[model samples]
Target: MSESSESTIESGGIGLSEDALRTLKLVADDEPIPDDDPGLRDLRALHAVVPNTHRPGHWILLDPQQTAHNLLWRGIEEVTGILDRLTHVPKITEALTVEHERGRWRDGVGSEYIEHADQINARLDQIMASATEELLTAQPRKRSKSLLTMALPRDSALLERGCKMRTLYPYSARVGVHEPKWMREMAKRGAAVRTLSIPFPRMIIVDRRHAFIEDLVFDSSPPHSGWYVTDRPVVEWMSMIFDLYWTRADPWSEPLDQAGRLTNPIQRSILRELVAGLDQKQIANRLQISEKTLSNHLTDLRTKLRFKTTYQVVHWWATAAENSSALELRDGEPFPNFPGTEGP
Candidate 1:
């Protein structure tokens, strides 16, 4: 690798430099492709390390995995989640190491208590760079675009390394302008980005061996200012918490992207809330859309369902819930079918 390639993170054959390539291995593109590079090229085939179009010196892989990684670092990360989506990985975590292990700390718990943001950031970068197998993360708050952008390189390295990773976010994250778009982009690169309706602490677990937990109770707390735990039990437990949420999370495969038309989750949310017997105002408040917006959504949904009144929509929803547990609602369908519900 040249100094230019070294300037950014190394994909390490795992494209640990490119999120999509993290699942792959790579070699730098040169004046001409080399045979040894060809041997390495098998892994790099799926990814391209884009040279800086405007700046000749700088180069990067257009990491697809960084989409989820983007927000995980937002609001101080919810890492692969808050993975810093600490959207934890279930396959790797399910098998916890049998023995209790410790780290280089004085307590030998291998844990570090970091109160400063800069120290936390530096340590996280160091640990993530060292991760060999997987990255699990969570991001509790809606992330800003700038934070997501800054995180691309770090998160992309994990993907490029082919390290397994997943990210967790609030279901509400879908409503954000950036979150939904980010989730869609990242999910394509083998980053498992899921959103939960419930609450979770901001965390990032790397390889299920090391974990970062922010000061969850205090919003005023500094970024990356939290405890770093290496105790196997604690890390395992955090990973487990992530799994519980993962089980309930809505995987981010959208309908229009797949085969549907009613593309908004908020509309589906409204229908669900309506079935729960909440009025429009309540449904709007619960889903965090404005009543006017909610009213418009209701109107649009009604038009799609071809129902004349709110009662008919509710009736169809209730009937669908009762009849076919096998039926699933889709965005493309005129009326949505929930995971276990029937469609009208």
Candidate 2:
């Protein structure tokens, strides 16, 4: 509706301005502005000063606090309506939806990239605080003591609330000094931690409702850059990746088989060589190791895998890796599955 064509009512000698009347129409009657009107500045000013507005015909009545609250709620609803359109939950494709949806966000996808450390941390704090059920994270980089200090309290608080927490890291994360300390502290707080040799994305998902995908740019001083995502499909997709890693990942605990898990740098290199079909002498020469030592490490690798042959060791490692899960993204629901591979 455009402005009510009703004649303006004068209160005593005073009359409502065109801007005030237009503004009243918007709040009370959902009127549309057909074009740029000079009166809009006054309308905006009226909205700024008044919390509640009403109109009987053409004149507007305003209550200071109520008018502001009314306008504030309208702004929030405006945002919600916008989100209702953009937030998408992709239709389930060939894959199964993640079982946990306690904190799923219905809002369509929208994103912001954070560049400052303070902004990123604040966003993280907000997400973690909002999480009512679970927190999933994949952090592929090294942790410094300072970062761990900042994270400790917030993470432990979530655990206290009985929220399931799971984190993913590369196998190398297990070797780092600070990583071990942080992992142990979190484990004590009832969080599950796992390591996969395969490369993992750097991201964090809170209650399946939000995801923060880390930026690949590491050049900034404080190193802050990532997307804060609330799109259902995107968050769910991230959840599946975390779950896939969870299934194939080695537990930070000792309940699982210790076999094939201890891979030192040299041994890891040798295994890579073997998988490349390098002979013992060729592998030894490349690593500048004596053939005898190379053979020892290779033998240890096979023994740890409980297989007599180097090929068997490679096959075993490959099989364990397949459980890491793969995703095929399409317009439809993407199911998490193990894509076919020739070998590890």
Model 2 per-residue lDDT tens digits across residues 16-76: 4666555656745544433344344354443543233352223334575876686677668
lDDT of each: 0.61, 0.65
| Residue ranges of candidate 2 with Cα displaced over 4 Å | 1-109, 216-223, 255-344
Give one digit per residue, the lDDT tens place, for model 1 in 1-344. Answer: 44423333343222223332322232233333333443233333434444455654333455657533543444243222334333355534533321111122324546666768778778889999889988888887777897777666688777888987789876667777778777766776678887654455788999998998875533444665688889898888788777655654566664222234442444555667766678988765455455887788778868978988978877776655323322233223333223446646
User: TM per model?
Assistant: 0.47, 0.48
Root-mean-square deviation of every model: 30.1, 20.8
The whole-model C-alpha lDDT of candidate 1 against the native structure comes to 0.61
Weakest lDDT window of 10 consecutive positions for candidate 2: 5-14
